[model samples]
Target chain A: MSPGSVGTVATQHLDLPGSLPLDCGRSLRRVRVAYETYGTLSPARDNVILVCHALSGDAHAAGLSPDPPPEGTRDGFAAAASPKGIGWWDGMIGPGKAFDTDRFFVVSTNLLGGCRGTTGPSSTDPDTGRPYGSAFPVITVADMVRCERAFLAELRIDRLAAVAGGSLGGMQALEWATSYPDQVNNIVVIASTHALQPQGVAWNAIARESIMRDPAWQGGDYYGTGRAPDAGMGVARMVGHITYLSAPSLAEKFGRRLQSGGDLRYTLHEPEFEVESYLRHQASSFVRRFDANTYLHLSRALTYFQLDLPAAAETIMARTLLIAFSSDWLYPPSASEEIFDALRKSGKEAEFHLIDAPYGHDCFLLEEARQTPIVRDFLTEGRA
Target chain B: MSPGSVGTVATQHLDLPGSLPLDCGRSLRRVRVAYETYGTLSPARDNVILVCHALSGDAHAAGLSPDPPPEGTRDGFAAAASPKGIGWWDGMIGPGKAFDTDRFFVVSTNLLGGCRGTTGPSSTDPDTGRPYGSAFPVITVADMVRCERAFLAELRIDRLAAVAGGSLGGMQALEWATSYPDQVNNIVVIASTHALQPQGVAWNAIARESIMRDPAWQGGDYYGTGRAPDAGMGVARMVGHITYLSAPSLAEKFGRRLQSGGDLRYTLHEPEFEVESYLRHQASSFVRRFDANTYLHLSRALTYFQLDLPAAAETIMARTLLIAFSSDWLYPPSASEEIFDALRKSGKEAEFHLIDAPYGHDCFLLEEARQTPIVRDFLTEGRA
Candidate 1:
């Protein structure tokens, strides 16, 4: 179906209690979760598939609702505005695509520490009745998976057909399989690793620092002021954009061509090259949609993701597929190798494929040619 | 020579007019050249070896004077500090080193449009009596070589020995032989190219744009205001530093390691990885010593460099040795192949060697084991 064809489903707020004790020796109470669903659930609810998002992703995943509200009708907290966009992953979730909306019902949710309809730094602190800001409890990947389980319970889904995602979403998929092996039958982890390598965490650290240093951040409590840390967020996006592309991809695309006009401006303010303008546009676009605090929170959660698999072989019940990109420096093929090795050692039916693409870590989002058949065969043929 | 062996030697500055008109359609006038000499000039003065610096190098090419002044004492209207106390190329030049001090009278100068003791954007505008700033004329690589010729004239030295350098310095060395064939006898173009391809230019453009976009740049007129564009310059340096190193180097040095003591802050302000901190330090050090405008000027000059040899393949006069590093993405071995092919096609005696080093573009600066013998043999043995 085309955009805006699906009907909107009202979601109930979920309160999930924190799992781990906080650093302050206290446990967080009443964690709230927000989510959206597509297609119809079967009588067994075993046909449910969960889609997780990356660092800046929100809950509105795939299939636009019919009679959607006009653009900007609900301010920043409402659904994303573009007609073609309910979520960033809409392309993979529709009829006969990867997620196959026709057969299996799909669910996507905003993470615990997210800005969109979830309990985050932007959410009100029940004790203070104001935004949590810096006071929002720091969280881990297990905590996020706990909230996802809560969302699943709210929908009365006892078991999921599969859980799949890329990047941070991929991390969540792995977390689901490991934390609740019986809950998930099929797991597809794309371009993600068991833990954040120092390099990955380093990049996120810089992005976070860029936001926190912005005067507009106001210690993460700038929601009412309307002066978000746009500049800092822009810088973060620029850095993130660089990491998303391989060196060869950058060389092929922008390779130092001057601006449209002939001569160099010989000044600093003017655009000297086209790539600079492209990066500037990317930075600007990111700042408009993403909350700086949420960016920080989600990035940290992704970094903290570590799966505690069964020590003995044959313990993991879920059949696994690990996909990586050859040029994805962020989560290279080596990471996939680690997962594949772990699954093999555990006597689980596992497969690994490294798509040869020059797009770097972003290949998962764009390499449809390489991904389609591999994912389709693995999901359809493997036991679930 | 421990940095203070050189005694008194007369120095001079000469002006060379640009051959082509700038973007403003104004031809540069009296393009001032600053240079220094070490060791006594032979009776014939044919023993002079011209030394060139990389993108941000200056005229202090050799030993410091016996009586050195305080830092910034001789600011000399350039964006970088005076090279009066220590020379950047001191490591390879001296008593019995590669370019032996007693045998060859070395001549090193600040390049045209350079900030260190040379006529660049920070130089006084003849009409306005203020720094040229954004009004400074755009310069070409050929123009820079011509200006070097003027400096040679002032020194009463007609080159007979050799010209050598790494990176941009190597580019100048190549230009010297092509632009003034009769004025040179031997040439060593190390880790450089005739023209910067799109990949190299892409990195340069990003770095240049970063400096220009910094608010402190003030349209390239931040001189005397003590408000240089440190942010932009820092970004520029960060980009350049990446090019100077290979992926393997980064992986080995900073791979995913957290900062010394702290855990991930879950905010955007702290460096999560050691590599990020390393990059920050590199950027900061560069901005402290180099000018933003000079970076733009030199990068543009590199982009425009082309060897103009008349006659299809038989007109190359100067004996040339082309050296490149396998891992140097900035000036890849492919570019050096083009240079070697052109020279060989002309039936010229040319030698090319691709040194295998993993340090990337900066390999030329650090690979002493590979460099010493090659450079020493090429310079000392031969056709004179």
Candidate 2:
């Protein structure tokens, strides 16, 4: 076993009884949540930390697969996972890491509308016994928090030591602290905005349009049609990927640089620029795992979410830490500053840090070296 | 006729003898140019100003409909034109406007790949007597300049008083001064870049993808099919429209303010934001007038174009005036500065002006109050 490897981890599903009422006045008769836990819960249950995943993230937060796959066996996320089977944010959640599994219990779950083993559009409808598809009720970030809170209740963890995430995950964390003020003591929001900007919403709208406009989308009921709108979904991914990157980053990586053996001449259907090739690859790889309907539902949730920090500041009990990247135009530092200003105006304790990371919004995921220390310092000391 | 209107504007087609050679080693025998001339050509022929139009623009510069519509009478561009037969640059090319058609004869032509009565993909193939369609030879900005040069020779015009345009038109202006240094005396390039940015190219690539991926496109031969890929073309325009406006402009103009009677809840295929509605309008109106293949060709030309000022500096005889908008992210001031710097390094006379216009790249066409004075002052004087 490699050093620092999370030896074994297991993801468990919790099927909660009773209807999960949503903000849209709709309710699911039964809700299923797939989650994973690391470290032992303290006797007092005071060391439990909840980690929220981003838009397309799953429950597996840290640690290796419980059973090593046999030679040549590859399937699901297991194949995508590292040799350690560690989850997203594994760098900050393991033993001696920021979240410090050895010192604090860490829990992660697939978001409510996510396709990864969660109760989403892909989940079987209790009444129809078929995938919900376009029939799936829309969910908000607050609803996702409520769902996650239910999972926490099932585990008998009354209060969270800390709630942390980035981007959409950060939105979820903010919602958790805002909705259940007493349940979370600390909050870390990175590269996120209190409310999605109109420009951001514009991009999301176009992405959704790309998918829904596809004939193969079949009005989001392509599950039984034997064909999916992979091309549309791919284009959406490509567009989204461009937003995730800064111009400077793209220029530095591929400034008019052509693909291998590529020329500067006009050729239809040919990717002359390296960036085009890169975006094409990103699009093709994304359609393999993501669900189109789930994307639609989650993207709608993002735009629909209205996070008024001034209103939430009065009720927010968590000591907040907001981190934003300098080059993240999608969710610029001004967004975090807005939340921080509101917290200050409300007489709440908060800290805001703008990292000079030119990697754009995805910096939270890619610049782990810079993000880990900042996150660790915030998580450990309550506020930086 | 309305006073100050460019009355009796006629679009004249000229067939130049001999073949027009292209950069790609292909030549079109007997090239046709659709152009509009305002004012009488001086006896010396030195009072002529060749006006270039941007992508999707046509041989229309200024003056509203020469004759007022009889209440509901509608015809071609005359229907779309303002009451005075005003052209796209109505603000800048009027009797007392910046270009001052009363003093200088102004000529504007539909670009090489344009569908507006010019020889393009929609034009008949002289050899086959059918629409060129996808078989149209790809054209570059330099090729566009060469075609315009042919038009000038056909008019027996030996020297131009000035050549001016904005955006893609600006690219053509630069190409003109570079290719035919002795033919043009002054050049005005506004809201343009010496070289296209990868990010901008990325957006163009997606827009083209949106059109090409449409099943209705039928490999660019959808003409006369009664069902062109309007949806895809519209989407492309929507994407392009977003790039043409600044985020702050969108925020100030539309914000997250939903369309009238719009809900905050999830609804499919609905434009919730006013900005989305605006984009839809822009896209729909564009698909009505613009051809899909022309968009592909022009967008490809933009990406493929590489303007090396050093190479053309020695031969560039036209004293140049470069203008950039303050909020034009698509082609910011830095791009203009690059050309200015190159001209300075090459010991050429040039002036660069950064205008404080927050309307983004389209500011050149929209913010003429600010642009008019700068352009007028430049054209009136020799050089800054």
Which CAPRI category fits model 2? Answer: medium
Each candidate's lDDT (Cα)?
0.70, 0.80
Q: Which digits, one per residue and each the tens of the lDDT, describe model 1 over residues A260-304?
A: 666566544545666667776676666666678888878767765
**In candidate 2, residue A139 scores what lDDT?**
86
TM-score of chain B of each: 0.87, 0.92
lDDT of 2 by residue, B1-384 (tens): 455557566567888789899887898876788888888888888889999988867786665444422331112222344443456776687676788878889999888878877788888888988888778887889888888888888899878899899999898888888878887899999999878899888888888888888888888888778878777787777777777877777777777888856566457667777766766666666777788999998998877777766776677889999999999988889999988888888898899999887778878877778887878888889631
Clashing pairs in 2: B62-B87, B63-B85, B63-B86, B64-B84, B64-B85, B64-B86, B65-B84, B65-B85
Top-lDDT structure, candidate number: 2
Model 2 interface DockQ:
0.55
Error of 1 at A362 (Å): 2.1
Encode model 1's per-residue lDDT on B1-384: one tens digit a residue: 344345343345666554434543566665687778776688987787888878866777656644443442122112144356656566466666666777778888888888777788888887788888988877776667767776676666666577887788888887777667777777888888876765565566556655665567777788899888776666666666666777666777666666755455543354556776776766666666777888888877776565543342244477787889998877888878888888888788788999998878877666645776776677777453
What's each prediction's clash count? 10, 8
lDDT of 2 by residue, A1-384 (tens): 454445567778998768788988898778899988888899999988888887756787776657432321122212344453446666567877777777788888888988877799989998999998888898889888888888788888889988889899899889888888888899889899888887788888888888887788998788888989887777777778788878888888789888756555557677888877777767766787688998888988888777766888888889998999999988889989999999999999899999997778877776666777776777778731
